[model samples]
Target chain A: MTEAVDDATLVQMFETMALVAATDDALRAAISAGSATLAYYSPRGQEAVAAGFAAALRPDDYLVTTYRGLHDQIAKGVPLRPLLAEMLGKAEGTGRGKGGPMHVSWPDVGLMLTTGVVGSGLPIAAGLAWAAARQGEGRVTVASFGDGATNIGAFHEAANLAAVWGLPVIFLCQNNGYGEHTAFADHLRVDHVAQRAAAYGMPGVTVDGNDPVAVHDAVSVAVARARAGEGPTLVEAVTYRLFGHVFGDRMTYVDPKELEAAWKREPVTRFRQTLVEWGLLSEADAAAIEERSATTAAATLAEVLELPEPGADEVLTDVVAPAGADATKRTARAATKVVVPDGSVEVSVRSAITLALDEALESDGRVVLLGEDISDSGVFGVTKGLAAKHGADRVRDTPISEQAIVGAAVGAALGGLRPVAEVMFMDFLGLCLDQLANHAAKLRYMSGGLTPVPMVLRTAVGGGLQVGAQHSQMLEAWLTHVPGLKVVVPSTPSDARGLMAACIADEDPCVFIEQVLLLSRKGVIDSTPIELGVADIKRPGADVTVVTYGRQVHQALAVADALTSKGVEVEVLDLRSLVPLDEAAVLESVGRTRRAVILHEAVVTGGFGAELAAGISEALFGRLVAPVLRVGALPAPLPYARGLERLALPGPERLLEALEWVMAYEG
Target chain B: MLLRLPKIGMEMTEAVLAGWLVDDGATVVKGQALYEMETDKVTNEIESPAAGRLRRIAQEGMTYQVGDPLAEIDED
Candidate 1:
C-alpha cells in the first residue's frame, strides 16, 4: 500500500503516460515502415515509470535509460517529432540516423545514453552522477532499468560503487511481471525486486507500478533524497508489460487470466479512476486528453514520413564528431615537411622537445600541458624548462589518476584548449583508454558531427633502455586501429619538434609518440617544416623499399647502408604518420623497387606491419617482384635479460634478414 | 661605444653572443634584450632591440651581451 498523490497532478501524470504509450505505438509502426525495417521495443505498460520520473526531474537533471526507453526519452524532454524521426531512421533523428532503436542519446536534453545492453546504462549513469557530485553541479542521475537488469554484473557493480561513493543517483526498476518470456517467480526468491537494494545499504521501496500516483510519489521521494546528497535509492514499481518484449514477441508465457487481470491494473486506467473519484476531471475531459494524444502522435508520424532519406554522402558523416567534408580535406592538406632553419643548430631529441613546447606555448595562448611531474622535471626533463619559462599557469601537475587526467584533458579540449597530455610511458596508455577511445575519439562522431574535440597526446615509447617489462612496451599498433585518431611517431629530433608543432596546429586529435632511445641521439636537421600524413624517404635506392618508423627507421637506414655495401640497392621510407597513412607514397616507392619490407617495434601478430603489407599487396599485386615482408618484435612479453631483449626487437640485423628474404623471394 | 651588463657582474671580461633576437639596425628601446648570450649554464638577453639606432659591435659566438661594449646606439 502507498500514500496517494494529489488528484490534479495524478490526472496530469496519467495523461502523460497515455500520450507516451500512444507515441511508442506510433513509433513502432513508423519504424517497421522505414527502409531499415527496424524493430522497436514499445514501453506500453511501463509508461508509469516515465511519467513518474519525468514529473519529478528538472530539465537540467540527466536521465540514462536502457533500450526500451522511448517513454523515458520522451519524459526527459525529447520531442515527439525527433523521437518519431529516430525510429524512422531519418537524418533529422536524435542521432542523425546513426544510432537506431538500441542507441538513443540526447545530451542536449539530458538523455545521456539509452543503450541496447540490458545493464550497461547503470554503470554509465553512476559515472555521470559521480561527476555531478564531485563538481557539486546540483545534478542527479536517474537510471531506469527493467527487472532483468537486476541479475546483471553491471547493475551490482554500479550500485555498489554508487553506494560506496554516496553518488546522487536513483536506480528505478520497472518490475513488469515477466522479463521477456520468464516470469518473476521463476527467476528470483524475493517477491519485490526493490528488496535487493537493502543488500547495498540503501533504502528500497516497492510501489503499485500500475498506479501513476503510486509511481510518482515513490519517484519524487527518491529524486528528492538524491538531490539532497543522501545518496542512491532504489524503487521497484510492480507492473505488467502489456506487449511482448519486442514488437514481434508472441508472449507465450503470459496466462490468459493473468493477462486480463493485469490489463485492469494498467497505470492509465488506475490513475484515471483515482482522478474521477477525486472529481479532478470529467469523463468528457478525460476523453479529450486521449483524443489530443492520438492527434499529436498522428502528427508526429506524418512529419517523420514526409522527411527525406539521408543522402549517399550522409553515410560517412556523423561517424565522427565535426562531421563534414572539411575533416577529410583538412586531413589531406597536412603534409609532413622537413624544416631546417639556417644556422639553427640541430639539438638532441629531449632538447628539441623542450624547445618545441617552449615555442608552442609562446606562440599559442590556448596551449596547456598536464601530467604527473610535468611541471617539475617532466619525468625525463623534456618539459623541464617549460615550468620555469611559462610559470605554473600553463604547466600543470596532476595526481596519478590517469582517468581523471585524460577525462579532464577531453573536457579542456572540448572547451577550446589545445591540451598536450603526457601519459609518462606508452605502456601506461592502457590505464586511460576509456577517455581516449570512448570520449575523445567517439564524442565528435556520436554527436552527429557537431562537436570537435582537438587534443594532442605526447607519450614516450620503445623498449631498448632496460626499463624492463612494465615500462618498455610499444603499443602504437593498438591505437592505430581506431578511426578518428591520427598517430605520429618521429625518428629524428627535428621530426619530434616539427611533428609536435604540426600536431598542435592540426584540427583533428593526434598521438605524438617519441621513442625513448632516440631522445639523446643527435642528427643534422634541415630547417624545413614538417606536416602530418606524409612519409619521408630517408634513403633513395631501387632494389627493395624498407618502410619503417620511430626507432626502427634508424635500423632500416642502417640495413639499407649495409645492403648497399653488399651490392644491393635498398630505399628507406620513414612513415612519420600512421593514420591517413602515406599509402600512395608507400605504393609508389614499393612499385619502383618491386619489393618491400615493413618494419616496426611492436609485436609481430596483428601489428601495423600487417596493415602495411596488405595495402602494398593490394595496390602493387602485379608490380611486385616479391610479396611484401614484415619484420617486427617477436610475439612475446619483453624479457628483462639484455640478450633476450635484443633478440626480441627488430634491429638492423633483423631488417637485413627480412630484406634479404624479400629480395630472394619471387612472387 | 655603449655597453650595459646583461645581468649582475662576473670576473669574465667578455661573453659569447649566441644570436640576436632582433636584426641589426632594428629599432631598439632602453631595457629591451635585443641579443641573446650564453653562459656556462644557460642563455641570457644581451641588451636592447631599442628605440634608438642599433649597431653590432659584437659578433655571434665571440662577443658578450654584458662585459664587452655590444654597440654604440645613436639616440634620435
Candidate 2:
C-alpha cells in the first residue's frame, strides 16, 4: 500500500470503483434488456480516476464533470437510488427527468454541474472556485473533462483565468487514449494534456490513471496546494476507454489488437489483483465487495425502474424563480432616483444606468460586475467609477475573452452570486452565446429548480449609429425567443433605471440591451422600479396603438406628437420587457384603437414586430380597421452609407407614414 | 484644407458632432483637439489636421457620414 493512502482509504477507493463498475454493468444490462432506454456513456475503464480524485476532495468541495460523468457522480457521493432513477427518467430523479443521463446536478453532495457541452465544466469550475475563494472556506473545485476538451477555446480561457486569479481549481483530464471515436494522437499535437498548463503558468502533472494510489497522491498534493491558495493545477490521467463512446456505437474505427490490449489492463481487475497481492484484501473479501456492489446496483435499478416518470406539469414548474425573490435578499440602500415635487428627476440614460448598478452593488453584497475595460469606467461611462467604489474584485476588468467573461459569470451565478456581465456590444454575443443560452438560460429548468442563475447579461446595441453592418444590431428578438431568459429594453432614462434594477434582482438570466443612441437622451426617473413583463403607456391616445420598444419608442412618440396637431391621437405602448410580454395591455390597446402598428429597429423580416403583429391580429381580430402594420428597418443589414442608412431604418417619417395609413384605412 | 470626418474605428462610418471645441474662424494649432464627435456611444475628440483658421461646416447635434467635411482649415 502507498504511504499516502491507508488500508481503509485504499479499500474505500476500491469500494467506490466497484460501485461505478457495477452501476455501469447494471445500466448496460438494463438497456440491452429493453428495460431502461438511455444514451449511456460507459465509464467502465476510467473508474479509478474519478474515485481517486473524489476521495481526495472534501464532501463540501465542488465537482464539475462532463456528459460521461457517471463514475464521477457516483464517487462524489450522489446516492445510487436517485442517480439510477435519474438515468431512468423518473420523477424523483435529480433533474426531474428534464436532464437525462447526459446532465445531472446534486448540489447537496457538491456535484454541482454535469455539462452536456464539451469543455464547458472548466470555466464553471473556475467560477465555483472564484466563489469559494471569496467565501474563505478553503474549499477547492475539481473539473473533469476528456483530453479532446483540452483543445476547445473554453479550456484555454478558463485555464488562463484560473491561473491569473490564483483560483483553487483542479483540472482533471482523463486522457483515455481516445476522444470519443478519434484517437488522442490524431487530435492533439502535444505529447500530454498536462503540457498545456505551462502556457497558463500552473503546475501540470501526468499520472497513471489505472493506479488509484497514483491518482490519489497527485490529487492530494493539488488539493493541499489549492487549499494554501497557491493556485490551480492540471492533472492528466492516462487511461483507456474499454467500451464505445455510446452504448450502441460500433467503434469500428478502433483496432481490435489495441482494444484487446486495453482490456487486459482494465482498472477494476488490475486494482483488485493489486489489493490481493498487498494482502490488504483477500480474494474472498474482494469478491464479497464486488458481489455487494453488484447486488446493490441491481436492487436500486429495479426500484428506480418502477418509479413514476415526471408529470407534464413539471415542464413549466422551474423555468423561473417566483417574483420578489430578489427582495428577500436585497438590503435597503440609498434611493437611486432623485425625486422632486414632480416625483421625478431628469437624468440621462447613462447616468440612470450607473445609478441602478451602484444601487444593486450597494444593496446586495453578492452583486458583482464583469466586462471588458469596465474597471476603468467602460467605453460608454455607464460603469464609470464603479471599480474604484466596489473594489477591483467585485468590479473586474477582464481580457478580451467574451466566452470566459460570460462563462465565468454564469458559474459565479451558479456559485451564488448575482453577476451583472457585459458583452460590450450586442454583436459580440455570438462569442458567448453557448454560455448564455445553453448554460445560463437552461440551468434552472435542467436542474428542475434546484439551482437558479440569478444573473444579467448587459450589452449595448447601436442601430442608429452608422457603425457599419457588424456593430449596429438590435437583436432583442433573439434574446426574447429563449424560454428561460428575461429580455428587457428601456426607452426612457426612468425605465432604464427601473428595468436595470429589476434585471439585477431577477432570479432568472436576463439580457438587458441598451440602445446606445439613447445613452445621452434625457428623461425623468424615480426610485419605483418597473415590474418585468409590464408595459408602460408612454403616450395614451385613441386613434391607433403603436406597440414598440427601445429606440423605436421615441419615433413612435414623435409621430404621435405630429399627428396630435393634425387632430389624430395615437396611443403608444412601450413594452419594457418582451419574454413575458404584456399581452393584456396589448390586447386592450389594440381593441380600443381598432388598429395597431409595431415599430422596432431590427430588420422587418423575422423581427420581434412580426410576433407582436401576429398576436394582435389573432387576439383583436375582426375588431380592427386594417391589417396590423410593422414598421422596422428594411430587409437588409444596416448600411454604412448615410443616405442608405436613413432609408433602411424605420425613421420618424416612417412612423408618420404608418400612422397616416392606419388613420386613412377603411374596411 | 478640408477637415473631413476621420473614421474613428474600423466599423465607424458616421459620427454625431457633439460640439466644436474651437469656434468658427478660430486659429487652431496642428495636433490640437478641435471637435468632439460621438461614435458608438463614445465621445472622441477630433484633432485639427493643420495649424489654420477653422471654418465650421457641420452644425452641432447633426450626424455626418465619414469623409464628409466637418470644417475647412484655411492654412495660415
Candidate 3:
C-alpha cells in the first residue's frame, strides 16, 4: 500500500502471513494437546519477514532456510498437506518422512534446503547462486538465517565469496532479538546484522520486519540488484520472537515486560490492523481471511495425522544416488564412455591427472574445477594450465575458504553441475569437515531420494614430505569410515586418469585423495577406462598376497619382485577405490594365496589396514596359512626431519619383513 | 604422404580441426606448425612431418576421429 507493490500484491502478502500464523497456532495447540510429539521452533513473530521476501521472489527462485523455517516454507508455497504430514512423520511428506523438520527439502517449490546446522546453509546458498549464474538463468537465491548465524565463519566466507564472484544471492537475516537462549547483544557485537555486509563489499540494508511492505521493498531492491548482476546484498529484517525459542520452553530467562510488549506488537496483529487502516480490507473481510487460513490448517493437520508412518525399510533407501542401490554390491560400471587411444604415453601421475581433468571438462559441459590456486595448477602443478585452457569460469580459483568451497560444490552439484572441488591438503579437512561429513555426505540420505549431491572433493595426502604433523597425515580412514561417500586412491598414472574421470561422472559424492609422493612418479598411462570398486592385480602369485594402495603399491611391487628371487611369489593387489572395498577381489586373491599382509602409509593404530586385515581374517578364517599382518607407519605424528619421517613410514625393509613373516608362518 | 589426426590424450577419440595455419598447396618443412586441432579443451598445433606440397583435405571447423586422414602431401 505504501510503495512496494499494488493492492493485489499487498493482499497476497497478508494472505501468506495469515496462513503462516494460522498454521503456527494450530501446530502449537496440537503439541499442547499431545496430538503431536516433536521439538518445534516457533516463528510466531517472523511471519512478515517470510511473507515479504517470498512475495518479492518468483516461485522458481531457490530458497535455503534454517530449522525455524515453517513460516518460510509456507510462504514459499510448500503445500499445506505435505508440510503438515512431514510434521507428523508421514510417508507422503516432502522428505518421505526421513528429513523430519530440520533437514526438509522440497525443490519443487524452490525450497532447496532447510539445514539443521547453524549458519551452514549460507555457503550452500552461495553455491546455488554460482550454478544459477553459470546457467545464465536470472534466478536469485535467498539464504534465510537468524541474527546469531551472522556471527559464524560460514556467513563471512559465503558473503565474501558471493561478492567476489558476483553471484546472485540475497542474505536475509531475520534478527528475532535472540539466538536460541542468548540475547543478540550477548552473541554478536555488531549492532545490526546488515552492517557487517560492508566487510564483504556488498550492499547492507535494515528494514522493519513487522511491516510487510517495508520488507517487500527491501527484498525487491535486493532481488533487482541480483538480477542485474550487481552481486549479493545483505538484508536484515528486525523483528522479535513472541514466544520462547522452542515449543516447550517456559521463558524463565526472558523479561516479563519485554515478552508482553513483543506480544502486543506481534506481526500478524500489526499487519492486519494496518491493512484495515489503509482501507485495503474491511474488518469482516479480514476475519474471513483468518477463518479460511485456520480451517485449511486444521483440515490439513487432521488428514495428515491419520496418514501411516514411513516404512521401517526407508532407513536403507536413498543413502546414495541410484536410490536404494547398494554401492558395495553394485556391478563395476563405467559412467563415462572410454575411447581407447592407439598408444600409451609415459607420464607422471600429476600429468595423467591433468589429462583426466582436461578430458572431463572438454567432453562434459557440466564438469567444473574449483580450488585454491587451482588456476595456477595448485601447489603440485596438477591443475596447471587448466584455467587458461578451460577458461576461469570452468577452472575456478577460490579463496582459502574450505567450508564455503566444499559447501558451494555440494550446492552446485544439487543445481546439476558436476563440480570437482579440491582441498589443498587432506589434513585441512578438519576446517571443513562439517560441510563434507554433515551436509555433503548426508544430503542424499536426508533428502529421502529428493536430492543428489554428485560432486568430487579432491585432496592431497602426504606422509614422507616432512611437512610435519598438520599437513602430512593420511586421513583416508576417516573418509572411508563415512557412509554415502566414495573414497578413491590411485596407485598409478593410468588409474589416476581413469578414476578421476569415473569420480566426476559418479552420481554420489566422492573424495579423491592424491598421494603427493607419487605426483612425479613416471608410468605408462593407457586409455583403459577403470570402474570404481574394482581392484587390480598388479602381479599374480600364489605364495602370499600384499594388499596396498597409493605410493605403497610400488613398494609392495618391489618387495614382490625381490621375494620372487628367493623362490616365494607374492601377489600384489592394488585397491584403487576404498569405500566400495572390492570385497570380492580381496577375497579371491587372499583365498588363493592363503596368506595376506595389508600395507598402507597411515599410522599402524586405527589405520584403514585394520579394516582390511579384520575383513580378510573373518572371510578366510580356517583356510589361511598364517594370521594376517598389517604394515604401516609408526603410531606417531610425522616428524619434520627426513630420517624421522622415513622411520615413521613403511619402507622397503618393512614390506620385505612382512612378506617373509607371512611366507615363514608356522601356524 | 598422408597426415592423419593423432590421439592427444588417453581418453581423446576425436578432435575438432580448429584452423589451418598454412594455406592449401603451401610447401611446408618438417616440424613446422601446420594446423590447429582441439581436444579436451586444449588446442595443439600439429607440425608437418615432411616437407611437401600440402593439399588440405579436411575442411576447417570439422571434427575428425583419431587416425582419420586430415590432408595429403605430395613429397618433394
Candidate 4:
C-alpha cells in the first residue's frame, strides 16, 4: 500500500490541498465583497479528500461531481478563472454566464459534469467508463456524491449496472458528517455508507478522509483495479463540513460541540503538520505555498470581475441541436437503407413499430434498446422478437428502476450509442421525469452545445385500456412544453414507422409517444421516410378545419365521413411533430376553411389543442367564419369505470357533436 | 354442433349479445362474421365456426355468460 504513496505523490497532494484551501478563501472573500452573490457551498474542511483523489486520477480519466464540488473541479485541472467567472455571471465563464458555480463543467479537461441534483451523476459515470471499455482505452471514471445521495435510486441503479456490465468506474461517497442540515447518523440506516456496496457485488472501503496520504493510497488502489478491468469499487471518505449547507444558512441546526471537534481536525492544518513532522518541508515553505495559491486566486478573481455580461442575442442560441444537422443526419440515414417489411401491403400500428425497431437495429450498430420487459418481448409487444434477432447485448432488460433506465440512456447516448429506452406506460413517466426534464432536455443547451443527446424515450399512452389512473393518461403536453425536446406522436401506422425513423436519426433527444388504441388499426407504409414536423392533410375539404393528432386524427377523419352527406365539408389536419409544429399548414387550412376546431385526448385546460387554438386566433384574426372550438377530455382524472372512461375520452360521437356546434354558429 | 361464446379478457365472465349479422336458419360460410359481442370496455365481432345453417339460440341485447351456447350451425 505504501508503494502507491511515495514522497513525490504526498507532495502533490499537499499542493492540491493548499490550492483548494486558497480557492475557498477567494470564493468566500468575493462573496463577502458583493462581487459574487450565488449561494456557495464551501468544502473548506474536506479539501484533503479531493486533493488525495485528484492525485490518484490520470490525466485522461473522467470525473463527475456535485454542486459542492469546487475543490474537486480545481483539482481535476479546470482553470479557476473560468470557474470563478461562471460564478460571477460573466461572458468568459465556463458556460458563458449560463451555468453559474453550481453547474460548472469543463469536459475538455475530463471534468465532465457537476450536476445540481444529488446522486444523478452515478449513471453518467458508468456510461463514461463503459464507453472507454468499449474503445479498449484503459481509462477509469470516478463519480462523487454526497452521503444523502447514497439513499437515492440513481446511486443503487448505477452501482448495479456498473457491476453487472463490469464497467471501469469508482463510486466515491463524500460523507461530510452532514447532508444539508441532517447528520449522517440520523439520515442513514447503515453504520457506514460503504457497506451498501456489497449488495451490488463490489468491494467497499471506509477511509479517514482528513488524512491526505491515506485517502490517496485508497483511491490509487481503486483506480488501478478499475483500469485492470476488474470493475467498480465504492469508496466512502468520512469528513466534516465547516460551513453550513449554503453560504447564508445559519448554524442553529448543528451542535456546537460537534462543530468544534471537527474544526480541530481541519484537513489543511492536519496535513501541513504531517508534512512538517516528516521533515519533507519546513514551516516557512508551507506558508510560502499557501501564499502562492492565494495570490493566484486573487489575480484570477480580479480578471473574472472585469468580464462582460451576455447580450440579448444569447436568448435562443443553444436551446436545440444546431441547424444543418438534419441534412447530414438525413444523408447518413440514406446509407442505412432500413428496409420496411412488405412495403406493398398494409399492417397495424403495432406491427409498424416492430418493423421500425427492426429496421433501426439492422441499419445502425450504434442503436440499442433497454426497458423493464423488452428483452421478454415487452408488455406492449413492440419489441417482440427483437432480442432474438439483435441479441441480448443490444436489446437488454432492466430492473424496474425508471430513473436508472432513463439516466443510463442519457449517459449512453453521450457515450456514443443511440438508445431507444421504453418506460412501458406514460403514467410511469412520473418516476423518471427528472432524468428527462433536467438532464436529457437541458444537457445540450447547458453544456453550451458541446453535448447533444440523440436518444429516444418510447412510451405507450391512452385512456381506453381501463388500466385505471396509474396506467392510462395522455401526458404528451408535458414533454412538448420542454424547449430542447422533440415530441413525436404518430397518428397512423405509416407515420409510426416513418416518423420513428426520422426521430431516431435526428441528433436531438426526442419523446416518442405511442397511442395504444391506434396500435391495432391497420395503415399503409413504405421504406420512403416521412419528413418530421410536416403536418399531413389526412382528409381535405372546405367548410371547417379540424386540427388534431395521434388517436384524435382518426376521430377527425370519421367526423369528415359522417358530415359529408349533411351538406358540411370538413378538413382534417394531423400535426405529427408537436415541438417543431407546422404553423403554416395550420394557418393555410384555417384560411381556406374559415372555421377551426381543435381536438386532443389530454384535458382541455392546458392541452396542446389550446396552444393551437390560441395561435390560430392570433394568426387568422377577422378571417374566421366562426369562433374556434376545442373538444378535449374532461378536467377530472380518467376513472376505471367503462362508462366514465368513454365519457372522459372525446371520440367520434363527441367529434360529431362538436361539428354540429361549429356548423350552427355565428361569427 | 353448438357455438359457445369465447372469453376475450382476463376478468371477463360474460358478454352482451350486441347484435347479429345473420338470421335463424341462414346458411353461412366458415369463419364468417356472425354477430357482435360487447365486453365492458370494447365491442368485438364474433365469427362463425362452420359453413352450414345458422340457428339463432340467443336474442340481441341479451347477456350471455362464458361456455353458454349462442347458436348451432348444422353441417351440410
Steric clash pairs (candidate 4): none
Tell me the TM-score of model 2.
0.87
DockQ of all models, two decimals each: 0.00, 0.00, 0.00, 0.00
What TM-score does the predicted chain A of each candidate obtain versus native chain A? 0.72, 0.97, 0.96, 0.95
Candidate 2 CAPRI classification by DockQ: incorrect
- How large is the interface RMSD of each prediction? 38.4, 32.3, 34.9, 35.9
Encode model 4's per-residue lDDT on A426-507: one tens digit a residue. 9999988888988888877766666677899999986888888778888888888888898989988989988888878878
Q: Residue by residue across A465-544, what tens digits does model 2's lDDT show?
A: 88888888888777777889889999988899888888887888999989899999998777675788999999999889
Worst 10 residues of 3 chain A by lDDT: A326-335
TM-score of each: 0.66, 0.87, 0.86, 0.86
Better of 3 and 4 by lDDT: 3
What would the per-residue lDDT of candidate 1 be over residues A1-667, giving only the tens digit for each residue? 3245665656768778778877865554332222124556778888887888777777778777877888888878888777767766788877676666666777777776666667666765765675565456688888899998888766776677677657688899988877767888887888888999988899999998776667788888887788888999999988778876865354667888898888887777677666777788888888888888878986777778688766678777754434233333233322223233344575788877776677677766667887788989677888996877787747877656565456556545654567788889988888777667666666556545544457788888759877787778888887888877888998888788778877776666788888889899876555466768789998999899988898888888777887877889989999999975889899899999999999999898999999999999888898888878888989888878999999888777888888889888855
DockQ for model 3?
Answer: 0.00
lDDT of 4 at A555: 82
Per-residue lDDT tens digits for candidate 3, residues A600-664, read 99898998999999999899999999999999989988888999988988999988998898888
Question: Model 3: C-alpha RMSD to truth?
Answer: 26.0
Ranking by TM-score: 2, 3, 4, 1
Off by over 4 Å in 2: A1-3, A330-345, B1-76
